[model samples]
Target: MSLKIKKDLKKIRKYIDKIDIQLLNLISQRARCAKKVAKIKISKDPKTKFYSPDREAQVLRNIIRNNKGPLSNEEISRLFREIMSACLALEFPIKVAYMGPVGTFTQKAVIKHFGKSVISIPVKDVFNTIENKKYNYGVVPLENSTEGIVNNTLDSFIYSKLKICGEVILPIHQNLMIGKKNINKNIEKIYSHQQSFAQCRNWLNNNYPIAKRILVSSNAEASKIVKTESKSAAIAGDIAASYYSLKIIAKNIEDRINNYTRFLILSDKDVGPTGDDKTLLMLSIKNKIGSFYLLIEPFYRYKIEILRIINRPAPETNGVWNYIFFIEIKGHRKSKLLEKILKEVDMRGAEIKILGSYPEQLIRENKSNEE
Candidate 1:
């Protein structure tokens, strides 16, 4: 290489080395502080019930409020998540379970919301993860922009005692990826998760009308299948493509540009205010007339925007005769107005379960062409 190119390469190497050293120093400082905190926590609370959502929320809010930097609120939130995760690890590594075999959208949401430093435990099913309590938190897909609601996730709420602690909205970008050796040809089969297939229904019908659409267990699974199967392509995210070493045959193949999947973070304990917040509730009403409207009227009167409301059959009954309504409303449990509304809900309902209050969904500005 020329002398100029060589000097530039050396400068890049020096910059990387500086970053590595900085990271090491940061980690060392964090470790020392974590150790001290752990000791203090142990001495104060001998029972080892040291996890405090209220305290954590306060810390996060303070960080965000006091932040004066190029980093946006979302970036600051993510940074603090990792910091908190590391601190928590000092006391005890938090096990977070999410729906995955790894490289799935659920996993992406979990990492995005919790940060990569968190101990992520992938579970096969939603209920299995929630019922185990082996996980401090569980991330599960609740709804998608195109596919509507995930009934299975909603049903788990009725069976498991786990509460919704937070919410995450991950932008869904489905790509038609195939093995590197498998160039573009007469594609015989298209593989994807049932939900992914549904989301891309219009695109599939229009472009690959003759291709046999196969439903796999997940997007990751579809990618895995396509890696070995010739003349077959899979619909998955960029992460899955990287994992399976697949080439993107077609990019952003979803039916809509703004496709997004909403996920719920479940925990045994409720979350507190982080300044910005959202609350999820599961309400069961008496099968009497106008009971549903009566239950929702309080929220309307309070001027709380109801983001979503999905009906799932009460497991107690065999048929769809009895239904449990899952509702997502604005504001936190700590808000004075929301506190009063909760009381009103209690008086107006047969049963009201406060699923937990968590930080509001982070809205990222999309600059990509497809979006």
Candidate 2:
């Protein structure tokens, strides 16, 4: 209300307006530069791929390294991701396929990793769309920290020819959504994916003890069901709530505060390694007592760090009780040391298969879109 205060505010506003104009000009210049790069690349090779995971990771890492804080590293990275995504659209439209039906978390992952620029094709089976060349890439869940591996996705990899080019770990947030018909009434029943129900069982027990439970194919499906059923509530995330136009009665109801799901980016093109990379292996060892130890011995000898190890029962149709070991190790398989160790493992009568060697994602660094 003071004249001096009003004068100071006017001066600040003038400076901000000037800076905003300068920023617009700089961003336009960057986009023009991107266009030139794309033109030159296509001229050299007609089949030049637009998405380079390794290069993108390098760029983000470099930005973080050079960042001097006004905005956090993640804030800068997200802004740059949007910038790149826009520039990429100028080159060509990026098409991504995901396991979905409109409002699933996989779609959220698609938007999270690619920004809101790509053409998202949501289908029941992501692989089918990818195989049919309906999209440039596919996104599928690999594993969950709380519920474990997505067997369907892993099984698809068993026979599919797709390569894993990138990885993202998205935190899962379960929310309670109610429809307009019963906006303020207590929910009589609940619907959600089985995993979601399990993840939020404690919260649900405490809040809606008498509500009946109905399992659905996905959290998205639960959201859709709640849209039509007034007495029913859904446990899904932001995407579902927004798509279905539901109100969130509760947020972050998952049992674990740090639940995360790792999703793999599937492409026909193989990606080169980033310095910080992870190689995934699915191998069936010989049915012998010392086979397990012998398979992992090479890692110790080479001083290679093993990130994770998971065992699953192989199909029983072969008339043998076989086990498949899914091992994840730091560094790419292309490294000389890893190559030598893999060769030694083969010599030790262990068959090894490389699922992928991709840049390891810096998890929980970026704020999650969902629980």
Candidate 3:
């Protein structure tokens, strides 16, 4: 409109263009450096792994610590994560497997943790896929804050040799969505995973009280159902809506505002401690009086903070009443104190299996993804 305003706008645009060029050159330089590092590693050892969880966590933590900006630390981390991901791809493209038909929250966690540069494979069974050497890593749901632990995933760990390498905390935002064909039609039926329905029961009751509710295998399945059906809606997350090209009628319809799901990163490689870590142990004690006390006494004596403990029936036990305990503690398995505690538990007649020791990732990232 004004000549002075137009001149100021032109000046800002010119500076932005220059900065963009500089950024491109710097990124190219970084990519070259990553390639050199990969070559050096290969020369030393042919079986060297390119992805290091402990190193990545340390880098992210350092970035967060030194961040001083108008942009939030989470924003900075997300940007750097993608940049690092791209650079790593230059070294070697990594493959990841997740439970999916596509558009599931687990896939979202894969993208959040590994970035889009990775080759993410959606499979019916993530655990078996990784175990069969079809994929380098896997991401599976561990627990939900509102609904509790995923028993199936926990059960898989009972027999699987995979180790937990990392964790992702995703804030789940369930949405009521409709396909393009049913945008203005009367909502006759709704489809969603049972967990999604349970999470959004109150919102559904308030909004679509008379709609017929149907349960599906997953939120992604619900989205797929709504994609082709007329006068139907799906209660799923943003990824499902985006993947299926559905229109979100209601956003964040979960009953609890703070609903979050924790997903575990599974790999064959074990990770070293990153100072702040959590260890998971599966223990089966002898069916005797004070067995539980014996198993837990070590943790108390060591003053180790117990994060969670779940008791399930041990199928392999000779006694009908024998149980398996999954205990998570706030320390690495390699720690001297934890090692001592493990020995004490073993001496107390408990068969202990150290599941994994991984960096705790409770810090929420504000990336705009599905869950």
Candidate 4:
């Protein structure tokens, strides 16, 4: 029986080795193909796009649809995402800018979307890094499931010309982490971002209501502070915890179980279409009795599906309770339906600006990450 078990184990190991060799050869071949694409891109057009969001979306969707394995569809898609990222990097490295202190959730989203091979530039201001022109793209948090939309990111869209090309939904799992300190250490203060504090309010109240809670710009910043302060703890995600070598005293302490944050990928180029796209529009109609109805009536007529509607103060619109509507609707801006909708909106003296058309992301578990 022992001999039989040993023989079987040796046979399985041989098979695994063979499979690894085949995978390596296939990856090398794919890299060669990517090199050919690189040569073609630089042959004439310096403005040629090395990355295509629409194409990548279509590929991942197809991967999910055709996947037949023990692994979940999400797992398969993630593996392919990294494969595509690596292949594309062979052609040209994708430089991405994200609002960060290195270990923020925004940085995780960037890695999840673009993979580890791309150059990730961390900056305090999302505008500065993206506007620098050195980075190929930018990633910023748009909204959170627990909290509402990130107003700063939305406001940035009002003036920034960067187009939203793709999106990533990160499943947030907040942890109570301690750096170089024992978990049993006297906890006097808790450090966390304002949003994270809100998300974990219930848990914090229940666990350490008496502890002084200090709000910081980002959870990453909180994590950094906790590294120096022995009597402090930080509410942060896995990235920060891992980066600072922090031990998690408590896991998934978010008040909401399904905490998720949606991030936007901004780029200079436009994606054609991926069948499933959402266009963002900001509009201000003429202040009148029926202006609001008239402004949105065309969407109903065109059978457009409005996903979300956010109203921001229109300072330009005088003191008539006038507001600007930020709308996310289904379909591309260039589509016939949208073109018709825009014409109707323009005729009504509505100041409408199409922020961008991007691939709509569905619910995804960013918590379950694998190489």
**Is candidate 2 or 4 superior in lDDT?**
4
For model 2, the stretches where C-alpha displacement exceeds 4 angstroms are 366-371
Whichever of 1 and 2 has more lDDT, that candidate is 2
The parts of candidate 1 lying over 4 Å away from their true place are 1-27, 46-61, 66-76, 180-186, 315-320, 334-340, 365-371
| Model 3, CA-based lDDT | 0.89
lDDT of 1 at 353: 79
Model 1 Cα shift for residue 356 (angstroms): 1.7
Predicted candidate 3 versus true structure: per-residue lDDT over 42-137, tens digit per residue: 999897889999988898899889989987777788888899899888888989999988999999999989888998889988889989988889
Higher lDDT: candidate 1 or 3?
3
TM per prediction: 0.83, 0.95, 0.95, 0.95
Error of 2 at 214 (Å): 0.2
Candidate 4: lDDT of 163? 83
Clashes of 3: 0
Query: Sort by lDDT, best first: what order?
Result: 3, 4, 2, 1
- Model 1 TM-score, all chains together: 0.83
- Residues 246-291 of candidate 2 have per-residue lDDT tens digits of 9998888888988888999988877787899988888877688888
Score candidate 3 by TM-score against the native: 0.95
The clash count of every prediction, one per candidate, is 0, 3, 0, 0
Residue 361 in model 2: shift from native, Å? 1.3
User: Which portions of model 3 miss their true places by more than 4 Å?
Assistant: 1-8, 366-371
lDDT of 2 at 325: 87
- Please give, for residues 1-371, the per-residue lDDT of candidate 4 as tens digits: 69999999999999999999999999899889888988888897877879889988898888788888888887887788899999998888888999978999999999988988888889777666667677889899999999989988887777777788989988888999988864566799999999999999999999999999998988999999998788899999989999888888898999987788999998877788889999999998867789889878899887999899998877663456677889999999999889998998999899888888998874376554521
